[model samples]
Structure formats: C-alpha cells, structure tokens
Target: MSMVVTSPDFRWGLKFFKYLEIAKVNYFTNTTYLANFLSKSIMVVLRIWIFTQLYRVTYATANENEIGGLTVPMVIWGLMIAQSLNTATRPQLSKLIDEEVKSGVIAYSINRPYSYILFHYFGSMGRFVSNLISNLTLGFLAAFILVGPISLSWNGLLLGSLLLFFGYTLDFLIDLMIGLISFWVEDISAFNWIYSKSQLIFGGLILPLSLFPDYLRNIAELLPFSQLFYSGSRLIVNFDFQLFQKYLLIQMAWLVFFWLLVGYVFSKGIKHVSVNGG
Candidate 1:
C-alpha cells in the first residue's frame, strides 16, 4: 500500500480543528465555572418564570396571539432567547484583559506565537460554545416546564441558533473594544457599566423596542446592541426569513466595522504599553 498523503487544505483543516480543540479545553477545564453556570442557570429559570406570570397577570384579558404588539408566546420565548444569548456570550474575558493590563501580565503575551487579541477572541468563542450548550439545555427546559411551550417551529429555533452564533461575534467585538479601553483610561469599570446598561436598554432586555416610544424605539433599532439580543430574540419568536436576512447583513456590517476598529486600537494601544504593577 502506498503511504498516505495529506493535502495542504486537509492539513489546514486539521490545524483549525486543533485550534478549536485547544479553545474547548481552555474553557471546559475550569471547575468553578461549572458551578457558576449551574447557579446562574437556576436564577434565570426563576426570573423567566416570574416574568411570564407578570405578563399573564397584566394581560389578563388579552388574547394569546397578541400583547403590546407581541404575542404572549412571543414575549416569553423572546425573553428566553434574549437571556440565553446574554448568558452565553456576555464577554467575561474582557475583565481578564483589564486585569492583565493592570498587572502588566499582558506584556508576556507579545512573546507568544499567536496574536494576543486573537487568542482572547478565540478563548471567548470557546466559552461561548460551552455557555450556549449549558444555557440552552437548562434554560429551555426550565422555561418549557414552568411557563409551558412558547410558540416556535423547529425551523425557527434552528435559524435563531444559527443567528446567535453570529451574534456572539458581535458581542465579543464589543467587549474587546471595551476591554481595550483599559489601554487609555485608568478605570474601565465606568465604560463597562455604561456598556452593560446600554445593552440592557437598547438591546431590549425587558421589552421589545417596538413597545418603546417611537423616537426611542427608532433610535434603539439603529444601535449596535439591538443586533445582539433584540434581533436574535425577535427572529426566534417570529421566524421571518426576510427579517433574518436583514439583521444578519446588519450584524455582518457591524462585525467588519468593529474588527477594523479593534485592529486600529490594538495597534495604537500597544505603542503606549507602560506597564505598572508586577
């Protein structure tokens, strides 16, 4: 038998797989994260349950099909999707970046073979993958059991899941930008706080933007945070292919913009590397 030969493309594919495998190992190897995942997941279940009941009480007379421009099931399901995305891709690594920057440990990263930012980005992706699996499994079960099934077809669920993957990229980029701000500012907590509140308000965490005053809703629709949770949640609950394409293209555009912005910031930030604290 002739010796086996691997093509360049095949070799590249193998390398890519290995990269993802390393990321997985990095994320899943942590024992504390597993505990935190379980605790937060339980809290999410209770939160969703309470919200569902509040809606039911408030809309006591409304039909199941519609409530404040959204169907009952849509609101419940939207909350699940929105919260799940938030839980899965909330950019925890940004804090690590900030800590590393503060302690000057980040300088060590320069000697590593891979780009520092890309390493963090992929690490975030690995966490996203693990969080997605855990949150979806536990959150969906809890919601279904407590609030009953929210109306969504299998196709819609599949489409929403696909879009969420793209959404994670947006989340990661935004967080990376915030984390990079540590390079300029002495305190990034202010920036983090601002971003968190902005995400909640503009991303439609408690209610859909459509229910907001027209001016505010229109503004929120234009904000990048909307693409993170609001768009994905709406797509899951409503299942509009045309709308999905629209939001997907919007996310892609924002992704490119942030990617370029991060590159620029990283270039400038590295130049000012004045490491303090060991």
Candidate 2:
C-alpha cells in the first residue's frame, strides 16, 4: 500500500489557507460596502487635514529636525503609517468573541480545526487586508495632496514593513487578551477604552515621543504600547537599523508575554465554564 505524506510546514500552510478563505468570506458577507467606504474615506481625509495643519503650524518657527526629531513631511508620514496600521490591525476578535460567548456559540468554536485565537487573528487579517489597502490608498493620496511626498528608500520600506508586522502581531496579541477577558467581565468596553487611550497618549498617536517631555517620553519608551504605534511609525519615518532591531526585539518580547497570558486565561476560563456547565 502507498501512503501520502506531507511536511509539517505544508500542513500549517494549508491550515492558514483554510482560515484565510473563511476570512475572505466574512469580509465580503459581513461588510456594509458603501457605508464602510464612505466612513473610512471621511476619516482618512479629516485626519490627514488636521495633522497637516497642526504640524505646519507647530513647526512654523522651529527647526524641524531638532524640535521633535521630525520634519513636517516626516510627521505626516509617521501619522500616515500609524493610521494605516491602526485601521489595518484593528482586531475584531474581542467583539466577535464577546458575541459568541453571549450567544453560547463559543462551544461550537471549540470543535473547529484551528486554534480559536489564531482563527480570529487570520480572520481579522482578511478584513485588515481590505481596510489596509483602501485606507492607505485614501490616506496616502490625501497626504500627498496636503503635504507632497515623504521620501523613504526601498530598504527603509522593507525594514519598516518587517517592523510593522511585529508591531501588528503585538497589537493583535494584546487585543486577544482583552477579548479573552470577556470570560470574566460582562462588557470589555471599559478595558478597550483604557487601552486605546493609553495608545493615544503614550504610544505616540498625537505626537512623537521625541517631542514629549523627558519624563513622559521615558515612560512611553518603556511601555509595550509604544511598540504598537511609536516604534513602528518611527521605523517608517526614521528607518534606523539599530533602533529597528531594538524595537523588533521589544515587540517580540511583548508578543510572547501576551501570548502566554492569553493562553493561561484561556485555560482557566475553560475550566471555570466547564465547572459551571457552560
């Protein structure tokens, strides 16, 4: 008798393809096309407009390089990159997980072939790809119209893309933990709000950390939140290879930490639900 054989990597590739297919289906079936497009367009336009004015006015009399370690174009590009990642990597896992828990549909997910968290991750990537392409197109067009272009070499672009993947994964893991917390909390909105604000304030959303006061900037540098926004955005704008390695390392560390935390909570949550006959 002859038997078929496949490599482990090949099997995993097949699994990823399966989840990606499901994600594509969800993206098309679940998305409200016109509403999503119009809303995203408005958001990108408004953000690009506001930041263009803000940076131009703020840097009017200042030396761009010395003031915030950023020029006007650099600031705009940083914002563009950050916002792209924001829209692209906005994990829908928490909301979906919450709905499934409430509907008692999570039990069905337990029988699924893939890891639940990874399934959600891959599914989010499907939607994210759509959002990323559209958002970047709209955002970069608006940015060019408003501020002209920001130069990034091909090597910078490649490194920045690599850093962005790590940053996005770190963000996804964080979102995963928050989603898993739904097992204990009735609503995770407050937690999400806090996390978003932390990113806004400390993750270099409003301004680069270089522009912040020493104390505040120091704190942000030490936080995982900075890796989500600041590190990736800075890599895009600055593209320092040494800093790239450092931030990539930090993001990897945080990803591991959060992954372990999510696993622990998941195991414990499952036990609790089983005991309660959920």
Candidate 3:
C-alpha cells in the first residue's frame, strides 16, 4: 500500500485559501457585513471632503507655499495618510468584544483551541486590511482632485509606510486593551465614547500635532496617542531621523505596557468570570 504525503507549506497554503473562500461566502450571505462596508465607505468619503475643504481654506488664507514648513501638497498628503491610518485602526473591534461578553459567548471562545487574543487580533487585522485598501483608494482620489498631487522622497515614503504599520499595531493593541475592560465593567459604552473623543482630540486625527498649542501639544507628545499619527505624518512630510527614533521608542514602550496590562486583566477576568447561573 502506498500513502500520499503533503508538505506543510502546501497544507498551510491550502488552508489559507479555503479560509478566504469561506470568508467570501460569508460576506455575500451576510447583510450586516454589506451594511458595515457601505457605512464605512460613506464615512470615508465624508471625512475626505471635510478635510479637503479645511485644507483649501487654510491654504487660501495663508500662503499656499507656507504653513508648518510644509507646502499645500505636503499638508494634503499628511492629511490623507492620517485619514488612512484612522480608517485602518478605528476601534470597531471593541463593539464585537462587548457583544460577546454581554451574550456570555466569551466562555465558548475561551474553550476554543486557539487563544482568544490571537484570534481577535487576526480577525480584526483582516477587516482592517480590507477597509484600508478601500478607504485609501477613495481618499487618495478625492484628495488628489481637491488638493493636487503630493510629492515624497523615496526614502521618506519607505519610512512613512513602516511608521504607519507600527502605528496601526500600537493603536490596535490599545483599542483591544480598552475593549478587554468590558469583561469586568457592566457597561462599556461610556468608555467607548470617551475613547473615541480622546482619539479625535489628542490623536492628531483632524489637525497636525505641531499646530496644537504648546501645552496641549506637549501633552499629546507625551502620550501614546500622538505616536499613532504624529510619527507617521511627520515622516511623510518632514522626515527627521532623531524624531523618528524617539517616536518609535514611545510606540514600543506603549506596546509592551499594553501587552502586560491585557495579560493581567485576562488572567483575573478568566478566574472570576461567572456565567449567569454557572
């Protein structure tokens, strides 16, 4: 008797392809997925329009050639990059976690072969990647038509892309940490609201951190929020080696801090979890 053998690489590739097929089927069958995609697409367009108007107004009043040591094109590029990052790492994962906790389905996940954190991370990453491509394409076109083409040095573009990925990872971890708190809290909506507002106010989503007041900017720089946008945008528009090193350090520190915090919370939450009548 002869037995067939399969290589591990082939097996894994087959599994991944199957997973994508299943996801495609799910996407088509699910109305909620369609609705979510539509909503996200509309919001991305709205944000690009609003930001473009603001950029135009500012450029019209001030010299189009001068603002924060950036030309109009550079400012527009920075805004587009920041918008892409925001769309990619928005805290949509929090609602999923909250629903699972509230429905007592988390216990089922806890018993799964895969770790809950890793499962959620990969799932959210897939969603983000899909959203990032869709949003970036729409946003870049809208921005280019409204604000013209923005130029970037080859090295700066490379560094900016790296920083954007780092920012995405850091932001996702932070969002997960916040969502994990729902395991203990009775209601997480308030926390979610506060977090969303904080990101807008402190994360430099709407405006560059350099444009903020001295004291406010200092506070933003000290926190992890600024690391999410400032590092990526600065590299795209300015490209300072020393500043990049400093921001990278801040991002790493926050990642380590949140990893430990989430671990501690998960341990405690798992121990004390009581399912209605369990």
Candidate 4:
C-alpha cells in the first residue's frame, strides 16, 4: 500500500507575491498619470539646464577645466544621477502613515494577514520604480544635450547601482520608523522636514561632496549621508577603489542600524495603536 501526498495549496511565497503585486499595481498606476509625468519630466530638464549654465559661468570665472578635481560634465552628470534617484524615496510614505494613523484606519490594517510595514514599503516601491525610470530618462537626456557624456567605468557603474539599492532600503527604513512614531505622536511633520533637509544638504542631493575641499570630503568619508547621494555621484564623477570600499562599509553599517531600529519601533508602535471596528 502507498500513501498519496499532495502539496499545500497555499505557500509562504504567496505573501511575497502579494507584495510584488502591490508594487506592480502602483508602478502601472503611477505611469498612467500623464500630468504628473509631464511635470516631473519638464522639471528634470529645467533643473539640469539651469545647473549647466551655472557650471559654465563658474568655470569661466575660475578659468579652470576642473574645480576640486571636478569638471563641468562631471558635476552635470552627477546632478542628473542624484536628481534621478532623488525622487525615488519620497516622504509620501510618512505622510500616508501619519494620515492613516490620524484617521484611525491603521487599526484596521493591524489585523491583516500581511506585514504592515512590508505592505507600505512594497506599495511605495511601486511608485518609486515609476518615478525613477521617468526621471532617469529625462535627466540623462537633458544632461547629454547640455553637457555631453561623462566617462564611466564598469566598477563605478556597478558599485553605484548597489549603493542606490542600499540607499533606498535605508531611506525606506527611516520613513517607516517616522511613520510608526505616529502611533505615539500626533504629528511627524517636523521629523519629515529634518530628514528631507538632511538628505538635501548632507546626502549630496544638489551638491556632490566632490565639490568640497579635501578636508570636507574627508569628513564626508565618515558620513553615511554621503553614501546615499554622494557616493553614487562621486563614483560617477570619479571612481576610486579605496573610496568605494569605504562607502560600502559605511552604507552597510547604517543599513544594519536602521533595520534594527525600525523593527523595534514597529513593535512598540503596534502596542500603542487603538482599534475600532469599521
């Protein structure tokens, strides 16, 4: 006699597939908004153009081919790359959480069969992918038209791409933490503002660390912010093996810290949540 065996109809991986489905739905949904797409695309071109002229004037005044070891083309390309990824992880995640928390709708999601944080992350990722693709295309087109191409290396490109993934993960984790804090605090606007500005000033959003003095650059070496916006752009402008290695180490350390922090915050946040049946 033989026993017949059959697999379970449901699998753990199905939950992950749901997450992917969330991302996919968001990506396609965001792409359908032609007005938003046009506005973003136009802004990418406009910003790059304005910067290109600024770089030309600054270089003309200084009478240098490169400043702080950075060329006109280098900075332009860096801005294009930085700006492209800039829109990837928006503070919209925090706003969504804050709104849900304020509305008491988060209570409903608590009993859902999926991870709440992962649900939000995957949902945001859908929009992130849509924005990234459109921004990159416009950024590169504008950069190329105005400044010409900058030389790139295999290692630089590869490492820069990895850094972007690391950056996005860390960014999402920070947003998650802030959003979860809403369970305790009524407002997260201040937190959001500080995070945004920190990323702008220190994360190399508009200004790459390469534009700074050697001492400042050295200081940035110890900062994780530089790893987010600066490292990618730095490698784009000029790739140094030693610098790339150092950035990898810093980024990994920050990623680990934030990963643990978010877990703790989420657990605490859930306890504070008050629920009402809808």
Which candidate comes out best when scored by TM-score? Answer: 4
Q: Please say which candidate is ahead in lDDT: 2 or 3.
A: 2
TM-score of 2: 0.90
| Residues 116-217, model 3: lDDT tens digits | 786776666666666677777877787788777866677677877787787777777777777788878878888778877777777777777766778887
Give the per-residue lDDT of model 1 (tens digit) for 103-201: 888787765766687677677777766676677778788777766776677767787777776777788888989888898888899888888888888
lDDT of 4 by residue, 104-217 (tens): 888888788888888888998998888888888888888988988888998888888887778787788888888888888888899989878877777877776767777887
lDDT of 2 by residue, 35-100 (tens): 854466567668868988988988875635446567888888788878776766654567777887
Better structure of 2 and 4 per lDDT: 4
lDDT of each: 0.76, 0.77, 0.73, 0.80
TM-score of each: 0.87, 0.90, 0.84, 0.91
Who wins the lDDT comparison?
4
Ranking by TM-score: 4, 2, 1, 3
Clashes of each: 0, 0, 0, 0
Q: Which segments of candidate 3 are over 4 A away from where they belong?
A: 1-35, 276-278
lDDT of 3: 0.73
In model 2, state the lDDT of residue 249.
Answer: 78
Which runs of model 4 end up more than 4 angstroms from their true locations?
Answer: 1-12
Ranking by lDDT: 4, 2, 1, 3
* Whole-model alpha-carbon lDDT for candidate 2: 0.77
